[model samples]
Target: MSSTRVGRGGRAAMVAAALVVAAGCSDGTPTGSGTSVPTSAPTAGGSVPGGAGAVKLTVDSTVATGIEVPWGLAFLPDSTALVAERDSGKIKRVSGGQVSEVGTVDGVESSSEGGLLGLAVDPGYPGKPYIYAYYSGGDDNRIARITYRDGKLSEQQVILEGIPAAAIHNGGRLRFGPDGFLYAGTGDGSDRPTSQDDNSLGGKILRITTDGKAAPGNPDGRVWISKGHRNVQGLAFDGDQLYAAEFGQNTWDELNAITPGTNYGWPAAEGISQLDGMTDPIAQWRTADASPSGIAFAKGHVFMASLRGERLWAIPVAGGKRTGEPQAFFTNQYGRLRTVEAAPDGSLWLTTSNTDGRGDSRDGDDRILHVTLGS
Candidate 1:
């Protein structure tokens, strides 16, 4: 695939040639390496383009299966995707229909909602060959850099640390923005007061260099990009606009347009509130309807994966503002959708969280689904 960075409207052009093959799965056991098991054909779902002139999309097939709580996905230049298992602390690669364990992150303290969470391939890979991962340690949630070589991961280096970690609310989503800076979404570790603290790292979107220091353009001379976010788990960019998917406490889940130095009302406001000095969400959904997690931008729309809601949402955007009602796809078809990523091929890749403790596990408890959007 070309290295050209496609504009928001040109995202569909990045779709690679499709290679249809039989679906395969790994054994039920938890092995760092997964073996392929022949499974039923890929199940297809989606709708024709309609509201807001959204592109037609179809969940055409399953890529890999038997994954245990696949959380983060990062692709290689050649279209190979590296998946991080949230509780296993293992990194697995899915190429074509084959799945194999690359390696596991040492010292990952897996608990409720912790362990290996997010993974991002270095924007400068092959030459740099570094893979960044956000995982939970004994004391806190931290970011580490490791090398991927010969199907193995080694040379782990802690890049950043000290973010609070709780059994829940350990926000863990990492991505490299268009500006080439590493951005992380962190939780307040269930510490509501920390969300409003500027001096603390938790409950903020952190912008930093690959070396772990704060990014140059940060509002302060530290990692804080924005504050007062309760627990943001999804981060993506559409053109120059950054969007975050936040889990609400009791009322509403939000999709907010992020800006540096801005405060997103957390304990002060669960969802939309015309509170003074606080930015409100562009779109908000009832907590039961949207426990939004990983999100991706493609073809002029932001796709969010819902865990508790058990669906995927397509929100159309025009000029940085949502243009129409969000469309729900694959509701209850795939149990607990966890992450949705725009592949190098332009198609959206989604991971299921069926085996993630909270989900209703099936034969192939977890899997990766491929989605293609078109007119």
Candidate 2:
């Protein structure tokens, strides 16, 4: 699957619409001994020629039997997916026609935004087999590494620690970059100002070695990659370009393409507009089109987890820009959509956030959905 971000005419308009909507409120670790070698800038797949209004994905099916308050999810090397249960602090393996909890992790602070939030598999996994997780800790946020061996939890170890925590805004998302390092997005623990402080780790996109130590090439000596974020819950690299999903505070939520040492305007700025040297969002929406969570790049589209909006938005992204309107689908049909992962089998793995305290829950509540790309 190839992927890239865009910012042209139609894409520009879609982003502008998102901002207009937001005027209201606001909102990787690597693998084993060696990290996954960085690949060339990714080529977004599901290619559909032309500019904005190019293409979109359809929801073929939704899996509901075996999930609860699903937060973050990652597709395994074997094409399966590991999904997190936000309230239960459990990791479940979903594949074939079955879903089962691999096991419940310990030391997870599962209250409100705490609990298991984001996940990534060791890039070398299946061959090396290790899983990385981001969860809310008693007093702060923490990263842990464990192995999903034969559907059970094995080798538990906390690799990173010391992030701010509150009942909400504990950003918990992790991804293994092509560079073979682990990248993490953290929240300000309800303390919005911390995102702008260099010494602080909250509300920033952090980069580190596969082993959880700060990467040698870090922009700052610490793990802080870029600061000034209010609450960022989604992180993805479409090639060398790293894009993030940020929650706006009473203003606009944003989708930004990150550059090394780039200051993404947060608490300081809501939606768009160049503020001094701070970079603005390539696209954004009123905390409504967005409230975005786990993000995935696949089939030439950027799939975002819209929490407050109760929708799975398909933004036809190309060359780093949005092509058309934020296609709002699954609006409350399945409650909140929290995570999306591109699957090896040419499909998608998504998590429902229905049971996440603020959403509407059903008998099945949260579950992982496996489906074909939409037309």
> Model 1 misses residue 368 by how many Å?
0.3
TM-score of 2: 0.83
Q: List, residue by residue over 18-92, the lDDT tens digit for candidate 2.
A: 334333332210011211111121122232332443454455666556577777788776677778888888988
What are the Cα lDDT values of the candidates?
0.78, 0.69
The lDDT, on a scale of 0 to 1, for candidate 1 is: 0.78
Candidate 2 yields a Cα-based lDDT of 0.69
By TM-score, who's the top model here? 1
Alpha-carbon shift of residue 278 in model 1 (angstroms): 0.5
Alpha carbon lDDT of residue 107, candidate 1?
75
Identify the candidate with maximal lDDT.
1
